[model samples]
Target: MDSTHEQRHPHRVVVKVGTRLVVDADGLPRRDFLNRMADEIRDLMDRGIEVLLI
Candidate 1:
């Protein structure tokens, strides 16, 4: 069910990205994963959410 009330978004978001998350087991960087993450961050910003990527 959907609420009849207004929806609110977060004022800010802090993302702590682990090196291992964006890297392969053999130590190679994962470009696809990074691109997806970047897109997500951009979406957040579009919704007026301040993103701090670390």
Candidate 2:
């Protein structure tokens, strides 16, 4: 392993986006929120974190 590489401790993460956060008052999917969350999840994956999305 390279000296500058980060070591994984837990090695995995679970991301549960609640219904309230994922939907509008009309029960529709919020595009902006979903896009933002997707970006964040991608970032975690890029960092070598295993993401379990629900």
lDDT, candidates in the order shown: 0.77, 0.75
lDDT of predicted model 2: 0.75
Which lDDT tens digits does candidate 1 get at residues 1-54? 234333354668899887767674556568876877789999999988899978
> Candidate 1 lDDT (Cα, whole model)?
0.77
- TM-score per candidate, in order? 0.62, 0.58
Residue 10 lDDT in model 2? 44
Supply the TM-score for candidate 1: 0.62
